[model samples]
Structures are given as structure tokens and as C-alpha cells.
Target: MSVSIDKTNSVVLSADHITKTIGAKNIVDNLSFDIHQGEIVGLLGPNGAGKTTTIRMIVGLIQMSKGDVKVCGHSVRHQFVKAIRHIGGIIENPEFYPYMSGFDNLKQYQRMSEGVTESRIHEVIKLVGLQDAIHKKVRAYSLGMRQRLGIAQALLHEPSILILDEPTNGLDPAGIREMRDYLKLIAREEGIAILVSSHLLSEMELMCSRVIVIQEGKLVTERSIGSEVQTDQVTISFRVNKTQPALEAVHQLNDVRVIGTDTNRSEIILQLKEEIIPQIIKILGDADVSIYRIEESKQSLEEEFLKWTGGNRIA
Candidate 1:
């Protein structure tokens, strides 16, 4: 959310340098970013990183008090209908007639959509891997199935740009994996640009080609998936024979922060990088601290979210 919209997505869907005020507070301030074509860009921040506001602006769901936005060369302010026609989104949980069959619900949507057709409806159902369950009533569908249906509807019209927020929140592991693979496939095959927002770091790391991090309604960091962020800290978890000698060896290392200790598992999270890990292991081994195993722990998306949001309480 804080990441300035760069020419990231390979195609620019929406662009802005705008501000929004609700009563006495300015929720979004001078925010600017780009979502390029056919790229999966991530918007991650604390719970309220102006993510929803930005999404709203792109979709013309909310009018920006200032600045300009264009989608596929149509102005969001002047050519709202035309610009929005180029986009598709599922901001929160999509609403549906609870008693309707999934196929019927999609039919209702298809009937109302300006150009989407029955075959397109079938295409999306298959793409979402919901063929077996689509005929089932919405009431019988699991939460994950419902979420997939939401995505199905978003994809129904074949818009050039897609947006999904917290897409994996309630999904089981299998559902999450399926959705990730499907999104990647469509992005490549259809050349559609995508912007996905989530609190789950690993999921974003897996699903996104690039990520834009936000915190406290402000921009924090925007980076590609493998882009290195300076940790200012590194952690190594290992199983060793003795605890005391391990502790002593780590303490001897300069500026190491010994966060925890135990008989079998001692966690030494120091302010360093992966480069120093070998030296630490060698020091402990020479001192007879028989190493069981050592590894660099990967931070979850939530942890990265917290760190980038300055660990601030979400307002």
C-alpha cells in the first residue's frame, strides 16, 4: 500500500497521486503507484494501509477528492464506465443469493453483464475448478468453495485487469494451492495484470511476482517477490548437544542477541545476515557443541506485515 505505484505490472491499469479525507482524518495521502500488465503485484501492509482506499479508487467505487486515475487509457473521473469495464475485482466477500445454485448465481450475473455469455460462464467455472460443486446450492458449498465462486464471477467477463483482496483468508491448504496455481496460469496465458492484497506473507511470496507493502495508511516498501530487504536481524535455529556452551559461543560473538535458550533447542536471533551463520556454527562446533542441525528461519507474511507496518496497531 505504501509502495509507490511504479510501472510494475508490465501494463498500467490505474495510476494516481491523491488524497482522501473522512471527516477530520485523511485516510490516504498523496499516494501514487502503478499496476503493470500481466504481472501479479502485491499490496501488503498493516490491516489499514490505504489498501481498500486505493482499490476503491481504481474501481471507481469511491471518488478521489484530488488527483487523476486511468485504466486502459480511460480516465477514472471522466470515463468511469469505460475505464471500469477494463477491470474486475472482488474486494471483500462477494454477496450471493444464499439459496441459489452456484451455476444459477453465475447465470444471474451473466444475464445482467453487458457482454459476458453462457460459454464464458462455463469457462470460468472450469477455470475455478468448481465444475462438480457449481451445480450444488450455495448453502451447501463450503467457505473455500464460496471464495472460489467469488473469483469465478470476477473472471467471468474476461477483464484485462483483476484485483483480489485477502483471497486465501479462509481457504484450506489445498484450496490455497489451487487458487495460486490458477492465478499464475491465467496471468501468463491471458496476459492479465493482477493486484492481490493479503496478510499472509508466504501466500503472497508464492502468488505475487512483486509486492507493495503499506503501514498505518502510509507507504512502507514495494518490492519484487525475491527482492532482498535488509533484515537488520538474522535468526538460526539449531538442535545441539549442550545448551551452555552454545550460549557462551553465541555470547562471544559480537552484538548477537540471544533471544531464547533451552536444553535441546536454543534460538539465537542476532542482528546480522546469512553470511555470519557459518562462523557461528564453526565457533560452537570447535567448542564441542555438537550440532544437530541449523537453518535460517523464514518469516511468515504476517510477520513481514507487522515489521513493515512498524508493528503499529491497525486503526
Candidate 2:
């Protein structure tokens, strides 16, 4: 059932048919997924979609009513503390000592967080781009900066996976860009798998390799980003030709359609079925028509997410 990187590719953290109930009302119902090493996975849902509840269960902050969770192959229930080695997480808003310097705050976290050290804290601070502001007190930090510090703390022990809830709650455009870049960098360089719950679907489309969408605590969709490879999208332009040849060529292939076109310049969308797009390009080239360029029609991540989930709230 775990098909995407969130649950399939050498799984680092996985939930097997997990359910959570509070006061006789089931909040999370039979949710399941896995997070793989070195992948960034996004969890998206509308309000009251059980996104938060599922996240809490992953972090072990709440007991699941059914099924089980595993972190890096260790059962979260059976191993408890030991299984936590596989992950680091921050739920909702991250908390820190407002009066303490970021360095001091990290130091405190270092003392409490197992298997962390002074040097490790420095490393994490640098990792989050907080090297220049390490000695600054949390009270002076901006909301975005505080989020980075929270991430630095989360990475203190160098866990294989990171789980975050609403990680970008209070950041402006610049801050959001910074956080997005930094998270992508860490996921690529540190080989850390990240699972983030967010309402920012567009941003997640750029940062995540795959996405798991939930609606009303039930799994809506899980899909791999940019997984389709088509060889038929062609670049075409007519120097002094009629639009009829282009129209005729499009009609030749049932999957072919127009993307954009102007008086002189034109683009076509073609899905490869029987042959490569290069064949079409060759045919057009043989017709003595000057070709400008040809390129594949790359699918927008947002479009894929929307298509996969159609993830609006249901009444």
C-alpha cells in the first residue's frame, strides 16, 4: 500500500493502518505511509482533515488507538525511546526559551537531548544559517528565524527523518524562500527524510519529492512527483508556413494538442504513444520548415497534486 517515497523507497519511518480516537470520535482512520531516507515528503489536507492528529501519532506524542508505527525499522510502541532515534519532530508551533540566547537555548536542548554535544549544536546552528545570529536571544529573532532555530534543534542528534507540523506558520516571502531552500539542501546533502504538514501546496510542490494527501483523516492520495516521462512533446515554429500543416500534424496523433501559439511562433503538446517526438520533428524538418526548438511538456507539480487529490473539504 505504501507506494510513494513517503512509504515505499527503503522506508525509514512507516505507519501501518494507524487510527486515533478522542472521546469516541475517530480522528485518524486507517492512515498509513512511510518516509524514506533522503526524501522530502509533504502531507496536505484542509482544516480538520486529521493532518495534525496523524502527525502527533508519528511523533509519539499521543497513543494510537489501532495499528502501529515504526521508526527506522524500530517499533515506536515496543522500543519507545530507542525507536525515536529514527526521527526528530516539531508539532504545531515550535517552542523555545524566549529570554535565552539562541546558542544558550541550543545548549539547554543539547543537555536534554540525548546523544548531542556542544560541537553538534554549533553544526546544527550553522546548518540552519544561524551562525551569525547564534548568540542573539530568541526574543530578538524574527518568526522565520525562530523556525530555523527550531529546525536546528530538531536536527541536533542527526536523525535520519524529520517530521514537522506547520513549519512555516509565520514567515514572509523571503523567509519562506529561505526555509524552502534550506530544507531542500538538508534533504539532499544530509540524506535526511523529511515529512512536513503544510497548507502551502505550491511551496510543498517544489520542496517535496512525493506527497500524501488526507481528507477527514482518511488517506486521499499518495503520488510520486515528476514520475512520468514522455518523449513526444515537440517544439515547432513556422517561418512562412500555414497553420494548416501544424494543425494537420496535430491531427495525425490523437494525443497531440496545442499548448501555445502566436502568429509566427507556436508550441504543441504531444503525448508519446507509438513513437518518439523526434520522429515528428524529423518529419517536420523534412518538410523544409525551419524549426526553432523542441522540448518536453513538463508537468507542473501543483497540477499533479490537484489532479491526484482533488483535495477539498467535503461536507
Candidate 3:
């Protein structure tokens, strides 16, 4: 479950000091980051945080006012076709003809994109978990199923990079989880670099290994999800029979910092480590406090995201 980023991985997508100016306003200001092979990076921001603008620039849909975005060592602006050949994306909801069957829809796309063979279409269909329902008409498919089919179409050419914006917009909880797991599986199994833009903070926390957050069209922070706090201190929470006694016991320890006490739940939150837990428990035991349960409770991605963005609500 360790998702610590490996800096040695080859970079598949590079945005070098990209900026987009509209009249007197700077929509995106000097934003830069890299997405490596087999990595899933989340593009997070508020309603007007330039997430879409940045995606557009990378996919060559909009012209950049300054700087360049390169995919597989090809400049998006200079070599549009060559750069885009390595990319497959769904900016918004994926579209397919309601009258057409899922297999037929993919077949039409295969005709349009060169080298998208029948075998490749079948391969992508299975990749997205649509093998059983692929012959069904598009009108009968659920929103989640359509989303999967859309992803299948995008992957038909086996692009090196996958870009998705608001990918889980209308999905139910189960659908969201399914999409999250599928994306992670694809990134690991195929070594495709994935850039996902979504407002679902919890999903991103579980799915992406790294996230690049932007605020006011500028870089706010880039962080790894599970190890945001990898220093000496580790946050832990203890539920005990006596909350006051547990707090008192843990507060007396020199290394442990008592964050807060939840009297209602008979719990105490503190920052310490595995080795220190035994001492804390011993102190509690001597004080007649019975430990019911103990677990690590790190600050969620939503909490840290709000801190980084100055409480600006994400869309």
C-alpha cells in the first residue's frame, strides 16, 4: 500500500512554466509539473482555478500565451499532431450516438483513427470492463457504463497519456469507486500516465499517488497522498474508558503533542510514533484508564487541500 513517489521514473508529460493570459488577466500563471510513467496525478482546483485551461493547453485545444507543454518529448504547440498522437482524453462527459451499439460506436471511432484494429477495440473494451455489455445499444447503458465505454474508445489507440476532466461528475458512490480502481489498475498495468481533474477529494485521496493543486491559476502545492506527513511525528488517536485521564497521561509525555480531546467519544488525539504508544498505554494503565482502541488518524486530503488553497471551496 506504500505509494511513495519514485523520482527516478521517466517523465511522460512535462508542463514548463505554462501561462495563459486573457487581456489583462492571467488565467494560468507559471504553472509547471511533471507526470511520470505509471503515475496517476490529480489536477485539483476551485471553480475557476484554470484546471480546464491547463488541460486544454496540454491537449493543444487552446493556444498557450507563454511556455510549452511536451508529451513524450514532442512540443504540443510545435508538433501538434505528433504530440497529440500519444494522448487520449475526455474533457467532459464522453459522447456516443444513442442509436448506435457500443461495439458499433467503437467501430466508427476505429475507422476514424488510423491503426485502431478490431483486436485493439476488443482489447480496450475488456480493459474498461465492458466486455459483457459492449454489444448493447448506447441508449440502454447506465451513466457509469457509458463512462467506461468512453474510456474504452479513448484507449483504442493505446496512448501513452490519459487525461480526464471531471471524470466522476454524475457517478453514484459505487460507480465512483469502480472508476477509481479501474484508473489505478490501468496506470499500473499499462504504464500510462494519467491526469485526472475532479472535485471528489475523498476519491482523489484514495486513487492518486500524487496531486498538483493550483489556486488562482498558480501552483499552490504538489504533494504525495499517503505520506504528506512523513517526518518524525505521526498522528494517532486513542479511545479509552477515561478521556480526561488518557489526555492527562499522554500530555505528560515529552515527545507526544496532545492535539485535542473528544470528551463525547472518550478519545484523545495526539502526535507520536509506534514505539511511544507502549509508554502512553502504560501511563494510562497506571492511571486506571482502560484502552479500548487505538489507531492512526491522519488529516484527510480535504483538510490539507483546504489549508493549501486558503479555504477556497473546490468545484
Q: Could you tell me which residue pairs clash in candidate 2?
A: 6-34, 7-34, 235-294
The candidate that achieves the highest TM-score relative to the unseen native structure: 3
Candidate 1 regions off by >4 Å? 1-10, 226-307, 313-315
lDDT of all predictions, in order shown?
0.72, 0.72, 0.84
TM-score of 1: 0.71
Clashes of 3: 0
lDDT of 1 by residue, 215-279 (tens): 54555555544333246766556667776667678777764544333221333333356677888
Error of 3 at 192 (Å): 0.6
Error of 3 at 84 (Å): 0.1
- Indicate whether candidate 1 or candidate 3 has the larger TM-score: 3
Query: Best to worst by lDDT, what's the order?
Result: 3, 1, 2
Model 2, runs deviating above 4 Å? 1-9, 226-315
RMSD of each: 11.6, 11.0, 10.5
